[model samples]
Target: MSKLTQLFKKAQSNYDNYLKRDNVDGLEETIKAFEKISQSELNATLKKATLTELQNCNEVLFLIAKSYTAYAFAKQKELSYTDAVDSLTKANQCYQDITNYIAKIPPFSLPLDLGRQNTEAEFYKHKMKFEQAKMEQFFIKHKMTGAYDAEKAYEALQNIATAYSTFQRVLEKSYKYISYKIDFGINDELTNSIKDELSEARTLLAQAKNKKSKRRADETPTSKKNDNGNTQKKRRLRQRVIIEEESEQIESLSSINHSKEEEDTYEIPASEQEKRQATSESLPTAMELSQSQPVPLQGLDLLSTLAMSFFAPPQNVSSPLPRMSSTLENSITAQPQLENTNVFWNQNSTHIKDSQECNRLLNEWSLIYFNSLSTPVSEKDNQALTLERLGHALLLAAARLQKESQFFGQQKINPALRIAVQLLSRSAELSTKHFNPELTMKELSAQYAPLLKAFANPGRQLYNLEYLQHLRRQVYKESLLINTREASVTDIVTASFKALANTCFGKDYEIVRDTCFEALLSATYALSKNNHI
Candidate 1:
């Protein structure tokens, strides 16, 4: 082989070795060494050169450098903008290095070789893109807020970004192309089947809830007690009907068998016979009836509840009779003593030994709870009637407690009676104040007014029936004129009688002795004698 061929072979081997380097530092160093050796060979060729020889050397060196640039980039440890720019810079330097060699040659009468310009253009294009990518990294990845000078720095970067047919063209080459596909593991048929099962389960759950709600509704004390009372009343009616049917059947049989004898010779004596006949006539049969069907005695269930509460000592109830020293017991007996007895209620009240005081306190507490109501009872508003009923129940319970708590033959005044009187008085006042004029307040007064009158009566000494009669008379009189479009003095007196009837338990003297009626009727009569009943 020629010496030139040997040197060329040596340079090729070294260039190949440089191409194998992947690390930036090693690749760059090897590239520099290869360039230096090639340049030395080109220089030696130029020094002795024939034109053909020089042209061959220049072409060979150019091809070698271009091949090395591409190879160095391929073996790059990391393919990023920084390394790309660095490689482009090295390639530009190699081209510039050849410029010096070309400058020494005679000027050619050729247009400027646009290849250098094109190469420079491509290098600048990539450089701008790299810088823009770095800026984009700052904006998109790092979430930078400040302004980016991408205009001055990477003008062609925007054009390159827009030309991308795919993410692979980007300087970073790290973008992902994301897409989605429906998972048909569950489809229309499966979905419909699940819906059917879910609907059926929901229906069953609703049925269960309804059944539970109905059971709870049935168990409410009001409905259950009303049903039980009605049932008992029905049973009594059935018994009464049976008795009347049997009696009528017996009378008919007797009358059919001995009609003439029953009329002519059935009497032992005139008076005795008449008496028996009269008794038979008076007796209610299947046909003959009386007004006001008797109300069947339905024993109060609440009384039973109260008895259970009284006799069965709850954990918190303190029995005053047993005289226990427990804190719970002290709490109960001390309720009347506490200025604010509202705090220690059911828990300590069970221990209450003094039945009278306990009853009184309970009634008082109930009345207080009732008096706390606001008006125009809406769904959201507290109900006045509920509180009033609670007070009534408490009073009824207190009555029982009063009797239960008394010692055998130890006649002590029932404090509950006083409390009952006070509560009734307050209830009457509230009823008068807020009660609709159309509704007869007499119903409430009928229950409580007699008790008041009995308390106020001078003759009874134990009761004051006179003052009660006076108060009730006023209530009735006022109620009568309250709503009357054309009420006169007469209306006031008539109402007073109705009030008297309810208050005095239908006693004849209730109507006669009412003070307001006496005054009202007297004035009416004085004005017109025909106005008297």
Candidate 2:
């Protein structure tokens, strides 16, 4: 069995033990086991599992939450208020997360009985219990001091009230669902009691607010005196210092607890640590490698270089002539030698000069093409001619880039090709708008049929197919714009099939074919349902 299967089995066994024991001991262990199974690997396994398997996983998670609640009750019975609060909080969060997952699954997909569990109601009830425990803990801690922090106490009370209200609201809606129609003995009675409690809690909260305001008002003069007098100011400063020190202590304790939890979750064995250290020591150092290796040019860098070379003006070359000959025989002999030297220099620089000229020409051509695209086309202009020119120019630039890419490697070609595809697609759109072909459906299909066939070249990359798909969509959309009835379902299906078929010869062919086939099937189904078959 796989590791996930083993983990699931372990979780199930622990859950069973927790259920049988009816105590917090087994429940704590079960929660820890479940937390381990909640790691990313297990999550990926669960996602890839079948629907039935996923349902079983969710069922286990739900039972775990129920066990947590039971554990909280057991802790409460032992008067372990802190432990009880912690368990209840975990239970509340688990229920909320499970409810969210259930919501994402289609309503019809869930088991009928699973919906009857009322996870949302459980979440709020546990949340209310947690708040109550927290308030009680606060009161217990302050019992010796005989001093109440109105803000903290009131906040706790407000949370309790909110949780109770939310729980009642969820329970009310639960009664309407068929799955929740079972006559639980105390559903209605408990809901009513909760409503009554919520009302009382709100009243107490309002009273607390009034009391706090009155106290503040009574202390205003004393607070003002403390702020003004030097002795009072010193006393206030001492209180501030004490508060900051207490806050620091609390923060440190929380951090220590967090670190302990992390250590418990991912404890590494001494043997594993030794192995990791050995592996690190065995690896070669970067400084030991040769430094003269040429760094391969990246796609972005290459494109930038191409852009700069195309736009930058050529640098002037200066050559100073040798001192003029003082004698006729010396001048004649020097002239012949200088001519030979100049011929040799030109021969050596021919490649560089040619490359520069190519860049200059390409720059000029691109500027002209973009300028024409930006310029408005007239009704009388030949749209086909304009499109051909733009398309050829883009293709030429792409070819030159591809040639340059060979000097680097294949890995650097894709980025430039993607940019070229975008330019070509944009040009296609401009062509369609300019032409605005007003033809019958049959005529439009015939016109685009050759173009589609020409574009369906095998051995093309995925990006190439993506561009073709974009072109196909634009063609159909433009056809619809010019003549509403000038495109047919057959045209669309044919184009889609051609594009998909082109992927059969590329890398990851099987995966791409399956995906494209599914997409095509979905599109065909949609078309048939609309009576466009």
Best by lDDT: 2
TM-score of each prediction: 0.19, 0.33
Q: Which stretch of 10 consecutive residues in model 2 shows the poorest summed lDDT?
A: 323-332
| Candidate 2: segments with Cα more than 4 A from true spot | 1-22, 76-86, 96-145, 177-189, 192-214, 222-533
- Each candidate: what lDDT? 0.31, 0.37
- Which residue pairs in candidate 2 have backbone atoms (N, alpha carbon, C) closer than 3 angstroms, thus clashing? none
Q: Write the per-residue lDDT of candidate 2 for residues 139-159, one digit (tens) a residue.
A: 333331355555454544444
Model 1 scores worst on lDDT over the 10 consecutive residues at 322-331
lDDT of 1 by residue, 1-533 (tens): 22232233334333333333332343344354444444465456555655444333433344334433444345333333333334444443444444444445443421132222222223222332223322222222111123323222121222222222111122122111110001101124433543443343334333433444455445433311123344556778867756766676676565456445433421212010000011122122112112213221111222122222222222342211100000100101111111112222343321223223333433444344434445444421222232234234334433343344433113222222323332333333234343221122334545545334432323323222224323322222211211111222233223322332332232222222332223333333443433232
Q: TM-score of model 1 relative to the true fold?
A: 0.19
- TM-score winner: 2
Off by over 4 Å in 1: 1-7, 14-30, 35-53, 75-83, 96-533
